[model samples]
Target: MYKLMASLLLGTSLTCAAAAAPANAKPYEHVLLISVDGLHAVDLANYVANHPQSTMASLQKTGVFYPNAVTTNPSDSFPGLVAQVTGGTPAVTGVYYDDSFDRSYFAADSKCQGNPGIEVNFAESIDIDDTRLDAGGTPGKPMTQIDPAKLPRMLVKGECKPVFPHDFVRVNNVFEVVHQHGGRTAWSDKHPAYEWLNGPSGTGVDDLYALEQDSLIPGSKVKTTGSFKAEREFDAAHVKAVINEIKGFDSTGANKQPVPALFGLNLQAVSVGQKLPKAGPGDDAGLIGGYADANGMPNSGLAVQLDFVDHALGELVGALHDSKLDDTTLVVIASKHGQSPIDPSKFQPTDEDPYTKMPGYAFHIADDASLIWLKPEERAKALTAATEYLKDQGKALGIGQLLTSNQVALAYQDPASDTRAPDFIVTVNPGVVYTGGKKIAEHGGSNANDRNVALLLSNPSIPPRTITALVQTTQVAPTVLQALGYDPKELQAVQKEATQALPGTPF
Candidate 1:
């Protein structure tokens, strides 16, 4: 009918336009990938539209912007990040969240004995002492700082072996493929647990710098993520490491090393701005963060963070130009996830009391999203009770939809087959955060605000064009490999999942 004809015409036009786009003559020598967590596609469009002279705006002039980039389901940091690097979902990557329960492992302190289920925590907790910036490790290397005793254990050849973050990942990542090809790679992030970026190889990143974000701010009585000021101070360390890497120096700047072919860092300031209830401890103490309206206009507090990030980006780009690598380097900006309840007024902090009261509930992780695991012996009885509770009290509990048996199987691997799969995946009403925390916004939900993030690819030779077709951030993996002149099939996950590069480009 008319709709089908219109769709065909639209497809034809898009194909012609893509065919007309210029192809790259040679691959870039370097790729700088940045993840500005909690940055929404709307935020990027709004910021650039309002600040025409901003660094993002300048990059957009030559960048291919995908305004409809969707992140992973559950939209938690770990899975979202894995998707970007491995071109796969949790079903293939086997990473559900930074904190998730796994039935295959033993407890962190269990020495591979007793119960088989363990809480897989790959966050600040793995640090020897999370309160210290060095995490009680040597001055320069953060991955070594991880406390083995804090990691989950698995029995291997009659010996108990601690599962490092890298070992938990199920698939090889972009870093692994690049490293295998002799391309130097480096990354900086907020936690030693991010060493998981090394993929299954455990030697993907030549240089990995991680400063714990939960560490105390020097001269202040606040954690790095406790306030906007502390978060900026924490991000500055990673930014410095990035600049040094761009100059062909090691993250510490004391050692001489070849410039990594792939290097990047994540920015935490904007995420804090979106979630923090107040600005900071000093003069900005009383100011609130989040947005002014549902239209995604940032408030004064969030605006301050945005401005800081834009300036930092300018510094990075300036360094690229000064190093004469701008022309040969491909710069990609993306976010792992986006925060919900942009209209701060919609935020509702609920508790897990009701769900816990269900007959067979054993454990659950309820953030903005909910994952429930029940006792296997009592699962049938528990599921019935829980279903009735949601049906009767869903409105008061801020419940939107409950995916129990068949529904969960349709979206992912069946719970009956996958022990890691939650028996119930509960998606709440928009803006309903399942926690006792004071933050106005949260991620890790099924809502659009949680999954739609900004994605941009910029190179001096690439033309500026906004791609409106819906794409997943998972495409970033193959796209990056293509930009570096490598076959995307080199990535195991890319081959397993059939992930393709983003359209509108010839790589």
Candidate 2:
């Protein structure tokens, strides 16, 4: 069966050149954008250096490797992923975190009444049944699986209307631009709530396969969140989807479809490998999965996960070659965020709840960092009190820098004006996770470990070189648009923020 598929792909490749002409006559016909969650830039550097025979090493010989790339502030998955696709930060995208609070929206049960400080949750909980593999939808069409009752609501002319994930975004993304300009687009992610990738128009991705990551493993009591082995299987399902799309079929492989001009998926195995501890969750063996030392060297379990991701990359590359899309396809490998506390010995988990006592505190999101929002009426006075309290208790709370609303306004919009901005942004000391979970590492902070992620742009026409100049994941949006011969200025946030394509690209 495998031999027949390869032969068929080879034949398809023979004719792909004539059939794969771009609408704008661009150099590249397709873009394979991949995000390996929790992959750090240093991790890529070490892996390539250590495994010279690996697929990443092969790409390094022809790819532009950005070693100093950083993600957005409040480096949670929602903002980090939006940065790469929209070329915007929270100020423009209006997405601080997946579970952050929004003062302009109403709670799920508000029904257009009462106060309007809604907890915006765009995670697996939005799925009709997050524990199922398909997220309570048919295999080929998962976008419809989002439960309207679980989404945030807004008063639309005296009537309460659910705000879908896509509608929550404030700007356009690369997927929207590409799809609007006569290109097929597809993406596979971990949750049905990832429909936000479709952009505000809700027409960016033609085929979106968002399988719930927390779904229960078949014949097992454990969820993928609690098992590294199940996590691999989850990743494999999405990988198989991408492979099917490579072979000119939909993600389900049951129907024929055009190969998407822009398509990719996110991998979660490496992330699970980083957070899971020795003999934790499903690991029967006592092998730990984090760094052995502070220098960022992977231990036995982490090394295995890295190997698995690399092997998956090889398979994707092989599929492209078999289908003859390798030359005309630009492969971009990046990460939404990276895990922190690489040195497990520095791990410090605290059960501190420092923000709830602050004057007029309405809500707070605390991970490695803390984002607090206060009632609007009391914000002015409460902000000052909270800053002083945080400073006075800095040592006890592991507060590194207490970014008052004034300081936060320097990078993002002023919380006084932006309904979604957090009144206080707190960066914590290294190795401090707010939750007392068994995981040794976490993200969602402004520290180096959480922000510095892997970024690589590989193509047949680009020269291989390492660019250490500081760049950002937001630059990826314009870079991808330019690669496809579209004007970067077409993106609203790119125009508003003056975002530029990544340097060192020949285009």
Stretches of candidate 1 off by over 4 Å are 1-26, 352-354, 376-393
What does the lDDT read for residue 390 in candidate 2?
78
What would the per-residue lDDT of candidate 1 be over residues 1-507, giving only the tens digit for each residue? 563232211111111111112224437889999999999999999999999999999999998999978888778888888888988777677777778867667877787777576567798899999989888885357656899888888889988899999998889988888899899999998888988988888888889999888888777877887778778777878888988988989998878888888889999999999988776655286667899999999987789889888988888899999999999889999999999988877888887455777766667777788777776556667777866765787787788888775666666667666767777777788899976776788888778788879999998788899998877777888788888877777777676667778887636
Mind giving the per-residue lDDT tens digits that candidate 2 earns over 1-507?
Answer: 563232211111111111111125475889999999999999999999999999999888889999978887778888888988998778788888878888888878878677777667889888889879888987556567888888888988888899999998899999999999899999999998899998999899999987889888777766786666778778988899999999999998988999998999999989988987754345657667778988899987788789989999999999999999999899999999998888778878976466788778888888888888998767777777877877887898888777788876766778988889888888888889887676778888877788889999997777899998777788888788878888777788787777777878867
How good is model 1 by TM-score?
Answer: 0.92
What's the lDDT of the predicted structure labeled candidate 2? 0.83
Residue range with the least summed lDDT across 10 consecutive positions in model 1: 10-19
lDDT of each: 0.80, 0.83
- Clash count of each predicted structure: 0, 0
Locate the minimum summed-lDDT window of 10 residues in model 2.
11-20
